[model samples]
Target: MAGKSKSLKWFGKAVTAKMEQAQILGVNQTMAASAAEAKQNHTWQNRTGTLEGSIDIAEYAKAEADGVHGTWGARDIAYARIHELGGVIKPKRAKALAIPDPKKAGGVILVQSVTIPARPYLRPAADTQYPKLASRIRKAFEKASKKK
Candidate 1:
């Protein structure tokens, strides 16, 4: 029997692009949800609302050789790190740190440094949402595949 020869075309770039699109979509969605959760579920008292307002996607989703990358945090607020991870805060300019005296209505106490306890918001939120990341990516991939 005689058969006609057929040529196979490689579509590595297109396939990779589609996979990356799926990853980006998944990461963006998860990061947004994580940030929202962090803002809503925080245990810290909102004084000026700056911390909550600043909670956002510090880095947008992007496709990389390893995988999709993204980040969410209160990037602008300097104290965000201390609150999230727990740390000692020292005065940057002054000889001592001036912290609010919780006992008094309007008072502050001078100290060499203040130790802040960790009241994690972003990491916990991310942890809660990241469990579904595989599913999210799968769905995104399906969606991307359907697009023209």
Candidate 2:
């Protein structure tokens, strides 16, 4: 019984370390995929060339053990949320804007409202990577467990 308990404790430590490594790999992969997708779709124009470049991964600690956890996403880009989930843009008090009509030369028109559609980049990237995530996690776990 004593020997069995010791082996079990060792197994737990190994598993925890492997899980932490797997979490890091998963987050990095997801962040890269998301950034690529955002750039490919051009959700945000590269005016200063910082929007797409700002995507990154953040590491955290797990609740159950000393294992690591992580999250991959963009930070501090104002339009990131709108492009990801999508929402409505309505003028205050239903105010309208007058702009020169392109079709009619020198003619002006009133624009009532503009609807911005959601061009989901992050979710699609994650979805594309989802099928391989399990395999990745398994590989990370196996590789870590093999180490001393």
Candidate 3:
């Protein structure tokens, strides 16, 4: 099928740009398997990994392959190794799921502002990990790197 026209080109730039942005935002990845599979497949949400909306698997994998993230030093690796084999990567390379926009708070909060606490989504720092402090800091790297 021919690609849909951007509102017949009559809607102009603003509308067209908004529509494009929406298109990307709506692009969901389901299982971390295929590009085709990623489309509209939001099953990843139930897992502890990055949000299905925030990242597609390719991007996540590339981030690690290129070493785009800030750092994952000894402590980070040790803490992560503690988790189950594959599960270690989850918290080690995580990102905040979309939080709710304050003005719009009804259904699932798809967007959120950074809060003082390490809100997970905000990628907040690790001030006190008494029981699991080191691990929390590592998770922060995973979450923060999602921004890059």
Candidate 4:
């Protein structure tokens, strides 16, 4: 986990990790954002034999333009700086809110649910489900159902 926490080195010491992430990886902040985008969606040397589809090079180009972060932790402070520019900042100066309500509940995050559409990139499989995503859920459900 040393490798992982290394990436987290840049993460905020202020609020929740996620809020910290948003605080950092906003649009237009390339250096800060590249890590999050790399984690979210990225591509690399494609060696697949089946040469049959298009590439979302535009997305890759945009994302890669920011540059690949070597470690996830190191990108955190940069991400937070980028988050401030976008106006969707996760307030850092405030105290932590572990307890319920009264004092901690102040401002809000982005209310508008913006939908970032997903497009296929680096087609590795013949069927196109992301290989790294949640695959075992359906299998678990089926396995559990047989006992009931």
lDDT of 1 at 1: 33
For model 2, residues 15-36, the per-residue Cα lDDT tens digits are 7667877766755665566557
lDDT (Cα, 0-100) at 34 in candidate 4: 37
Best by TM-score: 1
In model 2, the runs with Cα more than 4 Å from the true position are 1-10, 41-50, 58-68, 97-110
Regions of model 4 farther than 4 Å from truth: 1-132
lDDT of 1 by residue, 38-134 (tens): 9999999989999999999988998777887988789788888889999888888899987899999889988998888999998899899989787
Candidate 4 local distance difference test against the native: 0.31
Better by lDDT, candidate 4 or 2: 2
Compare candidates 1 and 4 on lDDT and give the better one. Answer: 1
Tens digit per residue, CA lDDT, model 4, 1-148:
5556433455244334333233233222332243344333434333441221221112221223344222221222343222222333333555432234454577444322333233332222212332322233334334444553
Whole-model Cα lDDT of every candidate shown, in order: 0.88, 0.67, 0.31, 0.31
- Per-candidate TM equals 0.82, 0.63, 0.18, 0.14
- What's the best-to-worst order under TM-score? 1, 2, 3, 4
List, in order, the clash count of every candidate structure: 0, 0, 7, 7
lDDT of 3 at 9: 43
The ten-residue window of minimal lDDT in model 1 covers 63-72
TM-score of 2: 0.63
The total of clashing pairs for model 2 equals 0
Candidate 3 contains a number of clashing pairs equal to: 7
